[model samples]
Target: MGGGRWTVVLDPHRWLELRRFRGLYESGAMSLREIAKETGLNRRTVAKYLSGRTPSAPPERAASDRPRRRVVDEVAPLIDAMLRAEILLKGAVIHERLVAEYGFTINYQRVKMYLQEARPRIAEELGISPGELAGLHRRFEVVPGAQAQVDWGDEGKILAHVGIPKVYSFHMTLSYSRDPFCCFTTSQDLATFFDCHRQAFAHFGGVPMSIVYDRTKTVVRRHVAPGEAVPLHPEAVAFAGHYDFDPDVLAAYRPTGKGRVERQVLIVRDHVLAGRAFSSIEEMNAAFTAWVPLRRAKVHGTHGEVIGLRAVRDHTALRPLPQSPYVVAQRHLRYVGKDCLVAFDANLYSVPAFRVRPRQLVEVRATKSQITLHATTPGAGGETLLAAHSRAVGRGARVVDERHWDGLPTGAGRRVTAGGDLPAPLQQRAQDSSSGSLMALLNRAAATQVEVGRRPLSVYDELTGTRPFTTHPNTKETP
Candidate 1:
């Protein structure tokens, strides 16, 4: 209302009022000046409202002519490159790489905002659908006993009070029935892993046609890139071969591939382990074993059938187990030390001295409860069992068999014998030497003997190097 033009901001309420006044003016019921006077507003403002043009509609502000600046614009190409390289790269990782490798000074929030717009566009260009990138996987069903999914659950420190540092749960679920079998173990080593598989197979009474598993080191020899042929562990291959089942190694980071067992891992924790204190892995396994009947009694949510009934079908369709289960062992090459001992698992086991030489290479085949040492070279007795010992429970223990040290010197002018006694010749020689020494001692002590009725006390005293005490006759006591 000053000399210069000023802007009039029209809120919705004020705009509605102006529209109502315009309606009245259109009807010729009120003059513009009269409406302005009644509304306590300026005449020109009311006239503008009454004009054919819609004055209630705010005037569009002219767009700014200055160029816009965005901090992320400079790094757009770098971000695109990263997205192209790894479609699932996180915005935080991109921001970190930008700051570290590309000298980007922008903060993480800005990078995250840019990713919100850029990720989908890049994914589309790369022909990856949004649903796929968002972890959408189709549900699948397998025929009874056709497949099983395996996964591991890490139960950290759950049994630490029982001296176990860590505990792991091994889960195997029949894909069709969703019947789960889980056991608790302290190790994921090759032997223990396959041993658990054996236990599961026994529990089910048969093996599936194929088993789906993650790229665990116990199953896979090493991790290969996507689409590459996965190199399986030698023991794993042998196990599968023996069981007549194929091992289906899942893609990296794809838990959905083994979703049945992955879900079973959680289900078991909720049903069996939650709020329960277990003293040992066996007790934990026993808890799962007890829960299995309850689990099988209920109708499965996905399959819509009693789990036990479905499992019956699955067990029927499975391949019959072999007469004897495959012996799963982790094999390693170790050199026998000069002491005729082979080192394994931080413990030393004796090898027969006649069977193995010092510095000889031997194959150590270890299972959960036993260690078997074998001679490696043909000249040294090809693949012969050198020694077998129970596995040491703790580290740094030396497990030796006295028979293994028979040929070695005893450092007492004799050699260790098989029966843990001196040899006949050595025994005779020892007896003769002892008898001669006793006779020479007696001959020397004869000069110190006194002529008494029996072996005199003076002779004994002189030989034993002690002074005999004497008492006076006048005293009442004798010594």
Candidate 2:
């Protein structure tokens, strides 16, 4: 054996054997041969061992005791207790605790070495160790437009429908590229869930190869068995099927498995979705659609590349958008009343009275610029349409039903003098009852003005003057 020391960890018994042999050699009581035979060591080797020499230790044993501690006995218990309590077991915290509580006066790293001896304990406390964590990883690849991540971000609220409060915002992201799709959503219900997906797809301009969703109730129903399987929610499954992409779900309590998507949600909340105010979901989405693509045009932190350009390159892998968005929200069915009006949201909206039937399924769309209604029927399951209305408010003759003669209320007629021949709304002369009213006075002025041509001051002066003579002789000749 090349010369190296073997640590004698057995309590002084083994050391006593060597020492007694040394004693025999010093006292001249026994030969090295007798001592070596009794101890089962080569006589020369026993001589060397007793003489304070060493042999190589086994590899596993050597690694463990490599860093000898200055104060292992003094601080070992304290390190054990700290780890048991799950206190953060960094060297600094251990050192502070040792000095403050246990009266340890050793150097900080002396405490560190003691703690290092107790490393196995601390690693167990942190759930997965560095080695385990490193091994339990997944390699995520983005097939460009083929895979994206969706999640909810921060929420906001405002008056959505009188007393009803709406969620202000949530976040969605692309998995492969770290691209974000974010917007406001009033609910995590099926309607809003699919709507957010619609907006996200529009934002990304394509579907992903697959989408990864957490086992949120908004997406998954319930686990069939603990750690076994989770049933995808009916609505979410239908939506995924409609999109024609594979649906991937992380296990029930395994949040770390989807950390990539979770991180994207946070980044979008911090950068894209927060600190903005919007009046309605539509308005919020409009803002998001505009803002997100411009953000994509900029560079990314992860890839150090332009996201928009990359997205363009990746888009070929995605499925084309459906001709129409999926509709899962319940719609109201009502009639255009005989008065050519249908009331919704505390406002009277008129549809073409004749074109609407008594129990027609009509879709009412109240957008920023207009309010419209489309009649729906069963044969095409809302494919066949009947009539539509141009939304009107403080009307200047807005057409509700084409059959109605005057579609607008009085306020509307009062605002327009579309034909200049009609009297203006502000200039009514009904209060003037005198024969010398402005009309009568205006008649006399007209007679003088025709004779005076454009000499308006002369006509006014002649009419107001005490003199009654008005007509010139050249003006009367033709009569």
Please count the clashing residue pairs in each candidate, in the order shown: 0, 7
The sequence of per-residue lDDT tens digits that candidate 1 reaches over residues 267-286 is 78766775457898889988
Q: Write the per-residue lDDT of candidate 2 for residues 1-479, one digit (tens) a residue.
A: 24543443453544554555566567676677766655545566676665666434311123443443333465777677766654344565566556655787766534554565577766676564533233355655556676776667545444444443656455666665667777775556556677778877876677776877777776777756666767877767777778777778876666666666677655544343333345666776676566565567668777788977776766666788888766544234556765666665446666554455545557765432345566664335644344445444433443455454254354654564332332443235523545334443334433343432266566777788744556775686555
> Can you give the TM-score per candidate against the true fold?
0.58, 0.39
The residue pairs that clash in candidate 2, if any, are 4-55, 146-208, 146-209, 147-209, 153-171, 156-168, 352-401
lDDT (C-alpha, whole model) for all candidates: 0.79, 0.59
Overall local distance difference test of candidate 1: 0.79
- Candidate 1: segments with Cα more than 4 A from true spot: 1-135, 379-383, 414-479
Q: Best lDDT goes to which candidate?
A: 1
Q: What clash pairs does model 1 have?
A: none
